[model samples]
Target chain A: MTLAVLDGGTYYHQEAIYGERLGGRFDRTIYAPELTAADLAGCDALMVADRIHPGVLRGKRPILLDYLVGGGTLIVLGENSAQQWAPGVSWEFRPTNFWWWLEQGGDPGHRIVAPDHELFRHVGMKELVWHYHGLLTPPPGATSLVDITPDGDPQGKGGSILYDHCHVGGGAGRMIVTTLDPFYHHGSFFMPAASRFLGKLLDWTDEAFRTPG
Target chain B: MIDAILLDCEQSETGAQALITDLALGPRIDLVPFYDLERTVLSRTRALLLGLHSDQRYLASRRGQLEAFLGGGGTIVVCGHIGHPFLAELSPFQPIHGYRVDDLVVNREADHPVWAGVDPADLSKRRGVAGFYGRGSNPPPPGARIINSLGPSRCPVDFDCRPAVGGRLLVHAGADLWGYFGSGNSSERIMPQLFDWIAKPSEAA
Candidate 1:
């Protein structure tokens, strides 16, 4: 199987680390800036970061919708800093300046693990140690997954949202909006478990691979 | 027991949706739209999911009711961009905003119950959302033990603050939890952990 990761400047450490660890999972992993409708014509799956907004995505890249609607899988990571083209959502993302908060004693050290999630099954409890800025908005029609909690409280307001996977035209797409820094941060890429988790996600995307019994 | 999960409505549902699905929280998470907020924050509600907005008017209007709810031992989770503002008003600590320093770090509390079985060193190395647009003041509501803190400056990251009013407030500045779930890594593990945290057993009450 081959996969294309949408690359526009936004880089994720997890993606790279996963690629390195699970390089053999897919035949090829292509990183490109916006997969135009035509660009996706022959691709098996597309991994997108927070590059394509709702406006630019509308009809322009029918291939994406078509791919998902047709049983192909699409995974979206990161948040649009400007919230320009994201359809069915509204909110602005604040860049992490790391100045004032650092002086006030703000450090990013926390291991977020969803013990019951399927993606973590093979790896089982991966730890990430980097802080990435996130988006602020409720993604309509998307099912939320994972949340940042302080002292055992999950109701906290500022965290990421993973949305529902739906069939659009002829493919399937999953949208995830997060504040956790995946690529830019360094420590996140160093963990072996983290790499395994990424590999699992890539493998799951393939319809041929069934979860081991 | 509270009947519904009350969420402050302002920013769209991006953040909360993650908790709802990933963590399996809020079968009844209610969105209290800023425009529709009345004097009382619905007496029947059990918890409040607060989202920060640019408009202070909306916050001020609901402050009293929220205070009352907290005093009554209500559960509240504060998130979104205006995390600093909400913490300042609800807790003793005042949140300081703006950019500061580099090399963001998160130190873990060895003795904290939340850190039980979790390694402090491994936890410490984990970097939180950098370039926080918000900040908080005062020590985490008095007895609130600091779970995660800034590197040298000692700013709190993940902590539990208990108001004198008897309510529990959990504060987290990071906003990447939802994305981790959507990444489709360990859905089996992630979902259960999320639901377990969000919907603690009744004994927790």
Candidate 2:
């Protein structure tokens, strides 16, 4: 399966996408500003990661929508504001608790709701412990994979940290989005969990491409 | 007078928004997208502030322009790990393995205006949590004044390098220095004092 990753040219994106660990996994790395439908041809999936300028994505919205409608997968990572560029994605901002783990009997509040899902077959709850940017409520037909209880609520009322949306753009394609920014932490050499999560996510995508629908 | 030209990567992250807000309130820093640096006029600018989220690969590709700016007596302050060889003097960031709180300590090596009245302990921890300042080292260029070091090895995490033939360069191997704004601590002194230091005429001048 051919995978195309958008390159924002940021140091973190450069290291995460093209660095030693997962560089060989990507089939293409298109410069974000110059992205066109032609640039995504023959690729099974295109990933839009964190820290990409929303303006650039807004400019390429038409091309992205076209790709989605053309039966190609579009994966958007966190902190890029999917609502600004992707179709039918609703994002709401919430204050992140970066110091939750430091609190007494504290919990970061992340859990894999869809534990049996193929995406979590390799990556697990332990790998998604870092703080998230916000909550995502995708349009109907979206499946929430990861859920987080806001403010460490004992009631467990929260939003999805990761989700998979089907029939996006009214096509056979799909979009997988998550508010967790693994690449930023992985590339920064912080948060060992981010590295493990990213590596496993890449493996999952590659495996998904190989399996016939 | 303009304090500096911040290379904006246009990210919507909280830290990025905070930096933007801080600069907007000051109105002295010009926000230029990283991609637009090639076309932006910089010869007259006194300093360039490169954030932790900057596109270092793009910066490396446009190294000539940056070198020219520095050669023309322009300062460049970079905050973050140097993953790519963007500038000749910078090396890739090396992370400390199995580090302790002491390793994260901010050791003041020399006095400078940018760090005036800033307590090392305050810079060392944020809200009683340590390791928020820095945990790695971006080896400074030779002859650079080590302003702050981290860990027992005294790895240089912050330094001021005045290349023999160019203006000054300040490198901070951690979060953006400007993000410290409104933190109600001496770290808050960094943004304003940094610009003040940049505006001052060098001894050569």
Candidate 3:
């Protein structure tokens, strides 16, 4: 099973650095516009950064659907603005709670709602949040992982991180959508708090997304 | 009488378009896609705003057109990371990592009129979160002035420069400049201040 990260090459320097440190598991650091169905044939997991141009990706939707339905893993990262296309994803805008960590007796409203989730392994309160782009509402039946709870908010759910597993055309694949963009922030050395969590998530993607031969 | 034309990178101009309407500059400001920037159009164009998320390679390809726009007395407000080599008289980007909220302190040197009515604290903190001020910087070309800094040594976050031929570049090395989101602060004043300065950069001097 091979892993790859799709980039538009705008953040060239950061992309190179992130591609390097994840050991050798992530081999293909590809440009989004040039990505073809053939590229995903042998790939077990494909990660799409938020910076992609939606027009270039417009035609690639079916190719992506095929890959996921064929039991491959696809991860869509966070966007600072509106994102038009991504399979089974709908976004919601939530005012970011940057000061939750700074309040007196600070509650740090972000929490790991889905404790049983594997992505949270070894991850604690500090690593759970930095600044999220917004909230994501994954399609039905997907597991919601982390919630960026604004201070004292009831219901305790706003879906900051999500994992979707489903059957497509009698085959199954996994899709993970997160407001956290470890690839962007980690590469630039900004998300240091989540460094370990990010490392583990990458390892999990390479392992969990592998399809049987 | 278009004062500024923000080459809208749709993905990056979050809440900024709405801010433009609030300023009543919608009619006077041109919001077009990055691909729409061209010499033929820029001749009649005024100030063009390029965000960090705007396509750099695409803009870099139209290098001559950009220079000419400046020479024709147009202003370009590029808000975000400054790495495009095509932008004249600006140094390559200097990536600034691991900076805390306090690290994004505005310096006395950044007292340019562009920052008028803007607060350094507001620039540093949005909803109590810091560190979004800037993630990197570009070297100030000779005669360039620093108006805001990321850390010591004046690694600038906001700065402006005059190219030899013409035009001025007000580069804010951070998210799109606007204060219109739920949080109303000094950042909200940036768009208007920038519009004012772009309208008359000499007065800002």
Best model number under TM-score: 2
Of models 2 and 3, which has the larger DockQ?
2
lDDT of each: 0.43, 0.80, 0.64
Instruction: Please provide, for model 2 over B83-171, each residue's C-alpha lDDT reduced to its tens digit, 9 standing for 90 to 100.
Output: 78788788888877778878888899988888989999999988877777888888887778898998678988898887655887889
**Best-matching candidate per lDDT:** 2
Q: CAPRI band of model 1?
A: incorrect
Per-residue lDDT of candidate 1, residues B16-110 (tens digit): 55655433444545545444545445556655555432123344545667678778766665543231244343433233333243423446653
Show model 1 residue runs off by greater than 4 Å.
Answer: A1-213, B1-13, B21-23, B26-28, B39-41, B54-57, B80-103, B110-139, B174-205
Evaluated at residue B199, the lDDT of candidate 3 is: 75
Worst 10 residues of 1 chain A by lDDT: A182-191
Predicted candidate 1 versus true structure: per-residue lDDT over A1-213, tens digit per residue: 455655432113223433333444443343332345555555566666443233334434456545655565566655433244333444445444334235424333233335454544442224332333453454545544454333212223444334433433223544444443333231123323334445545555554332232
Q: Find the 10 residues in a row with the least total lDDT in model 2 chain B.
A: B11-20
| CA error at residue B164 for candidate 1, angstroms | 1.7
What local lDDT score does residue A210 receive in model 3, on the 0 to 100 scale?
A: 44
